[model samples]
Target: MQDHQSGHQRLTLSDVQRPEYLANPYPLYHRLREHDPIYWDEEMHAWVLTRYTDVVAVLRDPRFSSAWGPVETAWMPEELRPQLEPALRAVSRQMLFLDPPDHSRLRGLVARAFTPRMVESLRPRVQRLVDELLDAVQDQGEMEFVADFAYPLPAIVIAEMLGVPPEDRSQFIVWTQDFGRLLDGGHLSFEELLTTLSGIADFLAYFRRQIAQRRTAPRDDLLQALILAEEQGDRLNEEELLGNCVLLLAAGHGTTTHLLGNGLYALLQHPEQLQLLRENPSLAPTAVMELLRYDSPVQLTSRRLTADVEWAGRRFKAGEEVLTVLGAANHDPEQFPDPDRLDLRRTDNRHVAFGHGPHFCLGAPLARLEAEVAFTTILRRLPQLCLATEQIERLPSLVFRGIKALPVTFASVLPATGATAAAED
Candidate 1:
């Protein structure tokens, strides 16, 4: 509960993990944005940026590099270094952690497959998946939203997009959960680090098999597209290919899942906003944007300084780490008036929920389409939907914000005619 008013010098990232802050961190975010926009946490040894302008500046500035490998492992204990080396090596190549020419090259190749037209073409299928998912639980008066709907919708969509067999979809649910824990940038217990590494190993292995199969028998899916993607005779190398594929799968679904859960929970909490969305279905697009702004799934992203620079009157040295608190930035009062309030029709959002600049989420279009379809479909189908319990458990990672489980009750509704058949097709 340390705050600027309490004479605390600085608030550590660990402070946000307390039950109260974990459930709702906006209050803390407000305090940071207002009093300590540029804070240096002695524990994390990183400068924390909470103000909207500062966060956006760091994200767009090339001086703040995205290459996190050296920063992440520099202080690691020698004993745990070897244990995490393999995982670190794989992550270092992923586009998310690369900088400049490497990131630009990798992103360009992948962008070809994720064009807006490509994502739009999948709407029908995404809609069908949403219908089928809801139809399964429509008969029951209650269901776990995260397990039944939120997780599967995007997971299946991304898996299908990658041409993964339906049977293999279940495995990713487990793998991605483990991979997510590694993204938090917090100190991990030895056991936790080992578990994350195991998941990373398995995920890369699975993609390796897919890559091999696609090399011989190419299909008309993203995996095959990625395999064949070329630019000026430059193609993704073996490790880069596998690393980015794993990134696509993990990032593709994990954040979208949280968007659905967090967005829905936000709507439910603000019943007026929920009613507004339900009444005016056309507001789906704006409503989705507002939801993303209100409670971003990805709360924080880190960057290592490429060169010494003075920003916001503070001189930061080269190689220093900076953590941009996106959640806090999204709610900055200077940027979004009455920032804490949920307004579905709010405009000029320009929120960094999916991030900003080159490292902006490549899967953003697809995520938005999936959420638009989901929120619209949920409201249309489950008119009586209400939280089964007020007590909800949020995922532990500070990097990703999400509800671990969301049990809800609603009046049972039968499947729409042919909805089940269409989904199965």
Candidate 2:
């Protein structure tokens, strides 16, 4: 309701591109929300869309494009352009990062593997994985929740879906960790960015080898479905296959890992809610939704204006950079009252954590199921669980907010009866 253009045009890049803001963006977000909700940054030569509604509108708006660069012009810095040109060229083929028609096509091709029935069919399997993970954590007095529980739940689920062998999960851990590091806009040095690009090359090499094997000898898994997916003689090209694989690995793993880690951290911080959850196991379904809304894992997404557009009495030029702050949008007072408070019992909570419109996450059901199983199993089995470390360390990426390590200590070996108990020794 407040739009004042007179004094706001003096905004500089330092205002939004500060390292301190990355550490705790909410304060800067508050300032921006109050003064200039949609301001342009000169340093990055881009516009920033911060207000909750504005961010959501941009994400759902087709006039604002998802495919920003890396097509004829990759977005990488000029210094490393020579080294990364090949890999950066493939970035445009990714489904989440692509535009309509292509985005819709690639998303649809993979949608069959993630249909509701397929996700539901795996519930029992997911429950088993959660049980096994929780049982291992229960035998120890202390555990790093992220490593011991959070990271593995979704990593395993994604691996199973992609037909990755159990032993190869370590590869995914390395790839995902490196991928996360390269995304740190505030902290990623040139060397680290190149390292991530190198890792991508390695992953592509591995995927190519695997694709060859899968193509010759198909299996009953998602990878096989991808390999065989053909519509009127249309199939994924080599670059598209590799790009989608990277997309799946990056999107599928990071979000779910943070979802579990962020959710459990919230529960531990709020003991009353933890106790309530321990008392009612059936509340897992509702609790997962609250967890997503309270502390969304993926904080922001980027877009570029394909054409000049006006909204809320402000005009944006074409080819401008727009950052949709999902974290802030999820906490907007206009949309969610007491946006700072976490309400597990709230009935009418509609959040844009997974995004909105055409960009809504395709893996929502699977991620939800995994979190439900992971959190319920952790809380139910380890009632004595409490933080072993006073201050948990978060991952260094601004785009993804998750604990790098969550040191938790428990009173005893609270193993669920009849469940296999494997010590974390």
Candidate 3:
């Protein structure tokens, strides 16, 4: 509930959802951390948690269930559940929304198929994609960083990783944008809900068709490997397979794109941090970690109580919603000294940007790799890069924080690099 005390200002998450706050919500996060770390809000009908310790506790505790309630009505508005039964099940079965045994089962197979080895192998490919993306705008001297670099870099990586056809990558990008709304919108508006439904339907059809084809003619990709993940005479059901595939497609790309976009934007905003990284290339990894903490891509995640539990001197009943303000937690003073400052060399950082415990993002390593590669390449290659416009549009998403477009200009370094190279001469 909104606090309307006369002559005394107070705020809530809804206040943080506006355009002004979206652009810069860290201050509000700071306020939450200092004032109401475990606030009960009537509007959200959830315990709004802002402290690092509390957010981590909720995330790691087994008392909290990630499973969505009633699969049929989970994906869309209550009224639309009848028509979207199949689509709802597909979404509801995703490991992101499951708990314990089911979560462990799906995660085991995915972890096996998408190991750190696989991510390490993509380093060269990710670098090439970054180069190619930058090369496309090398002559223009200006480009929309989000559309040109950030979006395409991760989109291409995820597409190739999933065995999505080279030609079909464009459509896959469109589908991914639609799916991102499922998480980012909180509760979707009618039009947005319809778009999400349509996206899920298309994805279900495509995943099923692809799974069927892969069974007939297996490919050497993550999807194929997942389809083949057989354990103790067990395997993914059609529903599980479809759900996880769609989950991978949606999660695999969108978060990384936002990371790239938000990380870049954060650097631009704090030129000193950008300068530090540019001068010291070895700091790339730490810089990425700092960026994730500085301006996290995924800002909020939720959990439901499975049983009544007492936490932080408060009682929360079973099945109650707990809203973890990840962005706020990342900036909690208790967790990080000088929480507002952008320190690329931030060492004690344990930000919950990717959450924590069982449901932590599987693609965290890959996202980190992409950010490091992207940041390193951009700094090394485009030394003259600068923002073309001060106007940066944050994504219309509560969960995902990213710029709509980061217009930028840099000196064309193509001729020098090209002129220095002579093919077999």
- Top candidate by lDDT: 1
Q: Can you write out model 2's per-residue Cα lDDT over 319-405, one digit (the tens) per residue?
A: 877777777777777878887777677667778789887889999989988887777677766758898877666665657777778
Give one digit per residue, the lDDT tens place, for model 1 in 141-187: 88899989999899898889888876677898888887787788878
Q: What C-alpha lDDT, on a 0 to 100 scale, does residue 78 get in candidate 3?
A: 68
Global local distance difference test of model 2: 0.74
What's the CA RMSD for each of the models? Answer: 3.2, 4.3, 3.3
**Model with the higher TM-score, candidate 2 or 3:** 3
How far out, in Å, is residue 320 in model 1?
0.8
What's the residue-level lDDT of 114 in candidate 3?
Answer: 58
Candidate 2 ranges beyond 4 A from true positions: 1-24, 70-84, 181-189, 230-233, 417-425
> What pairs collide in candidate 3?
1-42
Give lDDT per model, in order.
0.85, 0.74, 0.81
- Measured with C-alpha atoms, the lDDT of residue 388 in candidate 3 is 90
How many residue-pair clashes does candidate 2 contain? 1
Worst 10 residues of 1 by lDDT: 1-10
